[model samples]
Target: MRRTDVAEAWLGVGTAALMTALAPLAGATLAGNVGAQLLRDQQGWHRTTAVLTENAAYTETAVAAGDTGRAEAMVRWTAPDHSVRTAMALVPTGTRAGATTAVWTDAAGRLRHQPMTAHQAEVLGDLAGACAAAGVCLVLVGGRRVVVRVVLDRYRARAWERAWAEVEPRWTHRHA
Candidate 1:
């Protein structure tokens, strides 16, 4: 029961308590922000059918990489404003010109990727929360270990100095 043992214990407990309480709060906030962003993305994106403007033949490099069949090619689709929009979109391999293909678009009628679903947002939120909690625990535990090590090192050094002090004078007198 060293004098600083209580201090060390308190430091560890206090750190753990603070982290356990605060980490989840911060995590939840960040997760909520992420969910909100995903909601915005879902609202901004729209799906539409497009036509292949050219042959979507598979490239030699893609074939060598074991591409099943799909490739990217230019396609045209009518936007929400009924404006013509043409952009590169994924289509079946060897798709000929004038073939219809489905695509997604943004509010501006530009070709866009699919939006994240609610389930995907939930999963992402959970992952972010879990990572934050885990990271907090890891950092707190490591910091506590460092504190404990420093306290114990001081205790051991003092013990060694006291023991040496008691023996040094007696040994010197005996030798003389």
Candidate 2:
């Protein structure tokens, strides 16, 4: 508990905490940027209302799970060009025929996933950043501990050599 040791300990703790906190912020920023890029790329996609042509079908297991069961149904929608298009699309389970839902389509009237939302980007960024930070902290802490152990071992070896040198002549009854 020397002053230097106390100071070093505090510094290590502060640095670790700072790294952990900073990683999430960086991650969030990165995620937001990526999300924005996705939004930009999603330009020219058309959003239109689609009508379900049949009852949405879902797997029995998925329905039994009580989740928003994955379901697909035939849907019909007019493209931006004013031409009617028909295709199979994912829909909420139990949606009956004639129900209308919003969908995104490319210029050729092909279905596409929507752009990344801000909230989704932030969450993804936070998770990725936190995991990365944790990995970095673990590696640094482990490396530090290993180095400290090696240094302490070297000190102990030197101390032992000196102590043995002082006692060797007396123990052997030979004055140097």
Candidate 3:
């Protein structure tokens, strides 16, 4: 073979080998980026699911408390699967203690009437303490369940805002 032809052949072989070596690396880098994006998506999904689950639990507890005629500042629920759940709550009433405000499901899952109680104020205080610890606030106004509007300390609010901003991108709905 001519010297020039031999040189050309070697150059082509070297180019082919370089491409082969880089191809897998390039593919792997692309795959890794896609995998990371998928992981983030999954994490967002899990966070959304967790928020939905919490809302469902609170709703059930409120329904149960309202059904029992014992509108409380908090409700503890035991799921059919025997899982225990609790949440801060509120109940409103227009009348005095012992008055029936509403009907609620009892601990046994049976329907029953709930009467207002004098101990509610004490319960509300306890619930407030719990809410403070949980970064939330609770109040029973008019003997009804209501989540107190959270007014964090200024320093805490900044931190909360930052954290909320991070999670805000993942949330599509507003909490009431």
Candidate 4:
């Protein structure tokens, strides 16, 4: 093989090694950042007791066998300002109107999802990070491949033209 081919092969090997090393580092960094951000977003969230109200979706009949444990229900709760607020929240299925359940609320007394547990945050962060890492790896390696291929193709084309030019005069008995 030509020296250029050897160099190209080495470049590919180096790129692969670099990407392999970076994927995990990128994943971990992104995961930590995302997880930390998620945790921070939950900082001001608080839990409150909310009374379930009427919901058309749930009927007096027994819950179906496939009940998912939680269902959307109208609920009212007192905010920190002593003002009453109402909204839909997820509560245990089969809960009747007037039943109370724990719900999360933001500072503005708006219904919000409960604070994510550390495990939940980590899991979500890991997922996001993994996706980001995969994307990074793909773009880097794929872009490298395309660039290298283009450069090599152009080089080979030029070399072929030069070789043909040198041979044509002698082969055809024609001089420029």
Specify the highest-lDDT model's number.
Answer: 4
lDDT by residue for model 4 over 1-176, one digit each (tens)? 86567767887888789789888899999999999999998888898999988652653332564556777889999998999999888788778898889999888788898788999999999999999889879977887787678887678788889999999999999999
Instruction: State each model's CA lDDT, in order.
Output: 0.81, 0.74, 0.40, 0.85
Model 4, runs deviating above 4 Å? 55-67, 168-176
Q: Report the backbone clash tally of model 1.
A: 1
Over 4 Å off in model 3, which ranges?
46-176
The Cα error of candidate 1 at residue 86, in Å, is: 4.4
TM-score of 1: 0.71
RMSD values, in order shown: 3.8, 5.5, 29.6, 3.4
lDDT computed for candidate 3: 0.40
User: Which tens-of-lDDT digit does each residue in 81-155 have in candidate 1?
Assistant: 898878887788988999887787888888877777888888897788778877877888888888778866778
lDDT at 34, model 1: 76
Better of 2 and 4 by TM-score: 4
| Model 1 score (lDDT) | 0.81
Model 4 C-alpha lDDT versus the unseen true structure? 0.85
List the candidates ranked by TM-score, beginning with the highest. Answer: 4, 1, 2, 3
Looking at model 2, the pairs that clash are none
